[model samples]
Target: MPETPPITKPRRRDLTLLGLAVLLAIGLVVVLVVRQGGSDPEASSSPASAMSAPSAAEASATAPIGPLGDLARRQADDPMALGSPTAPVVLIEFADFRCPFCAQFGRDTKPVLIDRYVNKGVLRIEWRDMPIFGPESMSAARAARAAAAQGRFWEFVTAVYDKAPARGRATLTTEALRGFAATAGVPDLARFDVDAASVDFDDAINADLQEAQSLGIPSTPAFSLNGEPVLGAQPTDVFTAMIDNLAAGGPANS
Candidate 1:
């Protein structure tokens, strides 16, 4: 019979130290998230009709309206401000950061859309948040607002979803949330913290929810190309076709 292998006590100690290091790293990440403020705990929905009618400021930036243009511009927040002002075709995405489907769409199809259209100045994408996933979801929404406060809304939005755990939940646990803000390239974490704790972003998030409700957007990853709604996590081809059609100045299909 082969001799029994000797027990390695020193190896066990080394392994224990390695485990401690990893745990410390995780704890640090959690700390960063909290300090930076990723989400809020006070978000809730409001009546869609409660959203004030458009003001003159909104009207001035809207696209040309006759029939089709009127329908398209109605849902658009800005006519000259698609994803980037230069893009002609506008893509409105009503999303929830905590929604697994929305994250998947962001990870899978959005990059392609950006690369093929946004980068090419053909498609302008606007992201609207519908924070319906509980308290933590509110935090996530607030974090985005904080980022936008520093002119990094899209960057922060992308980072939050990207850093979310495999379960796709934003815990808003202070540390976890701050980690996201740091990654989003926000320069003023302190101010962001104060903003996160305030009611500044409440109206914005509520307004977005109202907008979605106005458009009958009951679920997430709901997309629109020039006012035609597309429900569910659709394939890239579907988006491509809609975008192409919009770019051609064709009437949108409901």
Candidate 2:
């Protein structure tokens, strides 16, 4: 396996701002504190527990939206995106393939979002490769883009998350990623391999990383729902309600 570059941790200022951004974007003040350790126990336990809304105390403690600029890059024909470009709501996800919470969201909650909002033309989901987990994470992000070149980005993502182990045991070696490409049914493995290592994909992945850093996002599975920030791997219903509220012309923070 080819060696991937070492990953660097973000600065303390960035982490502080990320915490504030979560408070501003989503109303889950308590969840942010808990997520610092790992996936929340309640969220990791089951889909049902994950989807339930936070208590009144948590909800009322919501922070004001920060300076996380216009997050929606609503470009038509974006390969790493799903749904109409003009959908009422855009859910921009900053995720790492190696993050267990990201895997949880991808495996457990994403399909539901796709079925309910994306299929209904009410939401557009755009993926941003925020690979904070080092070489393996960056390699997987590159591989995913390579898969996107063959029109199987989501398929590749599903395959990876489906096989992802518990947090801290990521299996994103180049060989393993190639196996994922096969599982995702990429027709040309040769082209996939080349594209995964190309300068183009590297630049593309870096762009996403820079964007996340600019917004002070220090974690995976962070989201921007039509410019509203939502941190952590929240449940299906929480996402559904956000979409529904947006569709009904409710406030982004509602």
Candidate 3:
């Protein structure tokens, strides 16, 4: 078993944010008890250090709103999003295709979340590409965006994660990605391949990377729930509790 490290707050850089950057930073106090596993593949299955989670009172006292809350795009037709646009909660995830912890969350925890909250119109989930695992992961993100254009983004994402190894990068070569795209039912593989190889998704993917950097996110599988920063792939109960608290009209800092 990989050793759990000491609890550390999210890194706060002495920098200014403007416009879209502000959407990912202001009021998003980095108070997450995340694992180090996602940042280092060798520690892939290491459990989260939830023993360091803040007390309920401490958590409530700092519940943020305002700019933090506005992080939810709620766009009516975002291809990479799940659930109703107006859902009470929005879960924004920053992840890399080659990160094991990210794949674990996708394979294990996310489905439960989808069943419990997303399906009920109580929550929405948006994906952000943080391809920090290098070239193959970048390729996967690009392919994912291309898949999105065919209205198969989520399917493509799930398929890639499902096929990925639990301890290393998935083979995301042009041929492999196209195969995955075909499996995901992307109607036009010819166009999908072209788009993936093009620079069409660079700006959007770079925006997500910059967003994560602005937040000082140091790992994959980082998340924001209606602006509440959650650092790792915690248990399903952890997510449900947060959603339940918000769903019941709990207090928040405006």
Candidate 4:
């Protein structure tokens, strides 16, 4: 038999045709399989998973409502209400009394804010003593609580902060704090002094300090407006925006 002729090379056109046929078959199979199932990725997701995904509104609503949100909503709504019981927002101020920023807030920005918003009954400002500035701070906080018992808390606080030394010193010697109480028109100075030294007052300040530590408040002049915690002496606009947002019945931004 004659030697078998060398196998002829497959025609380029035939190879190309074969490759196209294979690709077409694969594409058809893919199309058929996709059609058998739901073609949309969104449609393919299980209902439970779909439900777990947050909507934009839901995502935006996760702002820090603070540890006291429910309590604040129920008991203290006014953000700046000094004595008003009907205010709609409450501002929980955590202060060390000896922090310069606290002094600045109390002396400058606070007055303006108080006169403009607090006095108008849009907010209720409630002070909580952190006393991180040491013994003097604890003393001042105790005295402040004593004043509160006599309904002169705001006055005593205002006087102490207003006259705070430039170097962030707020001496709270028994006599000095008493002097502040007197200037703030606190009657029964002797009674105030006794109350300040009482175990009750010390316990109250200690409790506030413990709570502040638990809440991770690292500095003075921190605040929670409507139970949304805000750190540092943020600008007036921050407070205004929160008040405005809450008033609008919208959750605050994180």
Candidate whose lDDT is highest? 2
Task: Kindly report which residue stretches of model 3 are placed more than 4 angstroms away from their true locations once superposed.
Answer: 1-69, 251-254
Per-residue lDDT of model 4, residues 145-191, tens digit only: 77777778878878888888877466778888989999888888889
Query: By lDDT, highest first, what's the ranking?
Result: 2, 3, 4, 1
What local lDDT does model 2 show for residue 149?
93
Report the alpha-carbon TM-score of model 1 versus the true structure: 0.66
Backbone atom clashes (below 3 Å) for every candidate: 15, 1, 0, 14
How many steric overlaps does candidate 1 have?
A: 15
Error of 2 at 187 (Å): 0.5
In model 2, where do residues sit more than 4 Å from their true spots? 1-67
Candidate 1's displacement at residue 112, Å, is 1.1
Q: How far does residue 231 in candidate 3 sit from its true spot (Å)?
A: 1.0
Model 4 misplaced stretches (Cα beyond 4 Å): 1-68, 71-83
Clashing pairs in 3: none
Worst 10 residues of 3 by lDDT: 51-60
Over the stretch 1-254, how does candidate 1's per-residue lDDT look in tens digits?
A: 99988759998899999999999999999999886563322222434423433331243233322221222333344422235544556677888878877877877898899888888867777767788888878887887777777877777767766765666565666676677778878899998888777778799789888988887778887877665778888988888877776666665431
- Compose the digit string of candidate 3's lDDT tens values, residues 219-239: 989888767778888877778
